[model samples]
Target chain A: MMRVEEKLFQNRYRVDGARAHIEIVDGDVCAVHCQDKPCTFCCPAGCYAMDNGGRVTVITDGCLECGTCRVICGEHRNVRWEYPRGGYGILFKFG
Target chain B: MSEHFDAIVVGAGPAGNSAAYTLAKAGLKVLQIERGEYSGSKNVQGAILYSDALEKIMPDFRDDAPLERHVVEQRMWILDDESYIGGTYRSANFSKPPYNRYTIIRSQFDRWFSKKVRDAGALVVCETTVLDLHMDGRRVVGVRTDRDNGSVYADVVILADGVNSLLARKAGFHGELKPKDVALAVKEIHFLPEQTIEERFSVKGTEGVVIEMAGRITQGMVGTGFLYTNKESVTIGIGCLLSDFKKSGIAPYALLEQMKAHPAIRPLLDGGEMKEYTAHLIPEGGYNAIPAIYGDGWLMVGDAGMFVNAVHREGSNLAMTTGRIAAETIIDLKARGKPMTARHLAAYRKALDGTFVMKDMKKYRDVPAVMDKNRQFFTDYPHLVSQAARTILTVDGVDKKTKERAIRKEFARTRSTLGLFADAFKLWRAFE
Candidate 1:
């Protein structure tokens, strides 16, 4: 199995360390209402992961910004998604 | 201070670039905003450049467009777990000068196209995000950007934003896209030596091959896998509906690794170095899902408006065409000195309807629905067809008639005779 992290390592991204373009609007919705958190796995970049507390956590640094999490979080509408302030996200070397 | 222009084209991908290029060439003051570091930094595609579409925009594009290869052979394969039954159609005509299609690396290609837009007199702005539509009642008067005092007024606004068109959604142009409406695709570019690529795919210079497959690799999901030969890299990807991925709990990356591991596909990228992996969504909802294209002081183009013709694996062409046509419509309005009203902009729809874009879309409008419901087409047919091909091709002592019977019996047993006939009929209706 190819490590997705290694694959993402080959891509280029300029992280805005201060801002998160996307976040779960409510942690409770994810912790309680959301079961089978698809975002934890659906993200091609593996940006979303279950943390030690079993809550879905997202790190936007590795995001390719495909908007998979925003769309897939249809039930709760809990994912607040936005584009990183213009030059601050995934810069595909070979898009 | 607020900036004003005759037109504002948002998102500088193929559609936005095409629209801005055409509008600025006609001497309209156009402001094209892109969210990426540059125009193409956010775009991705399976990426076959249709010459006819670009030819309509810039007939001399082949001279310098960062093209990788001109496709000379097209292969369609149906894969089982280990085997694929396939066919190739290669022609000398495709290999000749003035080629039909070329595989493009979108980042380089879009950068080139965006430069052309800038050179054409449009004030192209990069690293700017359009935060919201500045509306006058129901009319989209301009856009509010994230920049300080970034409200840009325009006579007209063209939304050429790519697939995740949140601006349009936020404006209530269309409802949220259902998981069924889009397919999430992930791709990788595996770099190999130019000579190695030529030797492996059996082509030299600019000639390349494209292989498209549908089968068990999707794990009975409605999806396909593809490998395209670039100059020194191969673009390989697989995609299925978001719903399927959600339902099956199959990670798209895992699916790609499995596809790369397929026996028939492995050797082509056997020793290549994979450098970039990207993911994007393709609007597969066909014609039916196309939202309202024109509105008062506003118009939508490309993936934002769901203009992709998915059945034929044609999207970039439709994007460029729609972008060009939208620009042409606005230009006509300007010549006659008309307001950007819905009635006046409706001409864009009529013009698009007159082209092959709408005709082809109408032709296969049922495909997404048909293919979505019929999981067996992606699963059973690939296996049975590959089994049949292998059954007859093997050099064992089994007689030809006996082998044929064995294949027939296996098919009938797995999917009953009635099921097989229904599938044929469904295929005819869906594709025809």
Candidate 2:
């Protein structure tokens, strides 16, 4: 009877740096001034944030590794992606 | 003789863990292999774990599982640009002990389940990818890994390696998933003070709310959006059929952005700090999309076999349930001294059919197609509904009868009488 909503908050995996690996390459942040900063709006985790100057910065650590940015970047080629090394990334408690 | 196990289960998510744990508990020598550093490391979900499924495997899960908040309420919204019409269902029974569903972060949950698998006496090796199935003509006997001397034999191989299970495809068990049968989803977790989350969501300790959305959120694309309240963060996401993305030419992120900026949605996350963003594909092929699930020496479970109930946003439970059933079937077969063969393994399908997994999926089998063919439901209906609601709810001097007439006219303007009747009938039939 465990419903779908209750499991959203359980952080079952702690990012032990040894297993979870993420690297942000240079020029990966989308620089496009498209009417809507899609990444800024679309990322569920809000990993991509737009500053007052309209530049987008990403803090990779908090990433759940859902792969949205890669697809949404839309051939922008601003993001280089790979799985977090071995054991580090968003671990699901119930998923 | 060789480094042989009773079973080798690949991937350590719900399905893998369930299979591994069940087998190990039954005193089978099991080896669960994971490519990620740990279980759940490579997983993501707006995850709501079904207790009925897990309780069948681990009855005491509630006592020690890393559970987030027990959801006491659910909201389904049909959204337009700035308005949504939806109903909220909240029940105090959900807050009671032996709570039904809880929100979970995939990374943490999988690790916890993996620990249980190990505790149940399985040998779990992480950070290793299973490169190929060691096949003897038509039968799989073992797996070869990337590391040296990494080949291991087993009596049965369980493919729980997730959505894009390359091993299954390589073994020619299934082909590449079709675009229409899959959905690409993106989600983010925003960190907020626990107190703030509690206050904003109008909940006490460890209580949560989940909102599932449709309509303009997907911009005529066949997709949905979701927001779930956690203990200290909110998980929000949007997903659509891959075919929708290809045809619409609008990025998934754009849909997500619009969903987040929704006036009804924005207030909930006003001051929260954004945390993580990620995306993954979900297998939504339903009953028709399931591939060959078993062979002479192997069986498939979880996303590998595409056991996702997209209508209910129920994938992990299906994964776990299917995994458990697969394990149970193997146990029963072993007890009967039957060899693992496709014919014998079809029992797994029979079990699934008797359960909600297949039943519910079959119930909604035509929904995805119906929605896809009817783009007006996503585009025009929400706007019309919202405008009608606005007109009705407005406190202007219009008479009640006039307001009702205006609402009727609004519906007619967007959808002719026949169109409205057809939509209603289609909806009724689709659910029926």
Candidate 3:
């Protein structure tokens, strides 16, 4: 019954300040389309969620880099997914 | 700086390590690249190592590998919510030396395997990702890495870049992986005192138990849950097709928490500290989803090649076996002074087809499709069967014949008599 935040807190990451390795290619794609917003549900790290503004929002700092968001986008294919720069992103202590 | 090699291998998971180790031992100038900070920093698994795979790669691997515990018992469970109908296989033979399987932690195991690859004479480079494949016309000639002036040339490149395999996609070796063909699995490891684990799991030194569960835990998704006992920690996780998760709209972590809270599963991790949470994708599409594995001067191995045998929950073995075969193919061609053209590289696929790796995949080739189409197999059957088992086992003064009739009625309520027979036929054919 631990929170996703607490579970992610247990992991280690090398944060890249400039940009997230993954992004919604266009915010309008989520605003006008993607009613289910599967990324919100499938991402294990809880990096994606819907905001009050009727838009999908993401925070990549806690991202586990699982690539779920990349593929879950389905028809939209709006996520411009890339691995974080080498040496960055979640580093599993135990894997 | 750009450099050339006899071959370039991408990714450092089991597949890449096996390929590199074999190529290196064969005296090929191999450069193995990894995107993780270290060899296994990006890898995760429920992590049961089939000793046959590792032993084939390095015969004496047991002498120094960081294995968690050798498995002596395996439990398969069919659960509805609270109770489970389970079958257990325990063997004193499994407990003896030259064990068949062992629990492992990927980060530790990959590091050790990478070390072995290096010792075998391959150049293992970490913290460097292969961004793209450098192609000469249509043939893969080398790889372009993330480093400054990182373009390196080689006669052939082996793509062992795990399940995500962006490089393979970029090169158009295969199109986008259908969500239906892949599964998203999330797992967590809980730390406990070694003695506590030994006593709770009812095992002695280095002996482990594995539990594989299927039923309401996945909430009707086409998937299964597993728990593997490591030396001092327990690894537990559930996986379902991506398409199912998208349709179900269930948060994966929430699913994990709910599964851990299951009455039958909770006590196994009582008082343990959860240290890490990890998520990974498994190629579950069986033989039909396996893409073009070898073409031109390139070949695919491991998850990238979709060599997983989902029926047996075997990916790493297929990964290692595929990697080994690919390496052997390259070694044979090099020794024969042959080029790694698609025709020659066809040997890799041909040779793999002769092994259990491809044979098992072909055997269960229809499983994913059958499993995907049959929702009742996951939801209704588990509930009804468990209910029927309870009905038959509990003596409430009901006549034996009446109990049998009741169970039959319950089963008939779920499916028609013809439909039930057809379901059995579909299952038999799927596994045929």
Q: Which candidate leads in DockQ?
A: 1
- By summed lDDT, the worst window of 10 consecutive residues in model 1 chain B runs over B304-313
DockQ of each: 0.83, 0.18, 0.81
State how far residue B197 of model 2 sits from its true place (Å): 1.0
TM-score of chain B of each: 0.99, 0.97, 0.99
Local error of candidate 2 at residue B308 (angstroms): 1.4
Interface RMSD of candidate number 3: 0.9
Candidate 3 pairs with clashing backbones: none
Off by over 4 Å in 1: none
Cα deviation at A40, candidate 2, in Å, is 17
Off by over 4 Å in 2: A1-95
lDDT of 1 by residue, A21-94 (tens): 99889888888888889998788888888877768888888898888888899878999999999888999888
Worst 10 residues of 2 chain B by lDDT: B246-255
**Whole-model lDDT values for every prediction:** 0.91, 0.79, 0.91
User: Candidate 3: which stretches are off by over 4 Å?
Assistant: none
**TM-score per candidate:** 0.99, 0.84, 0.99
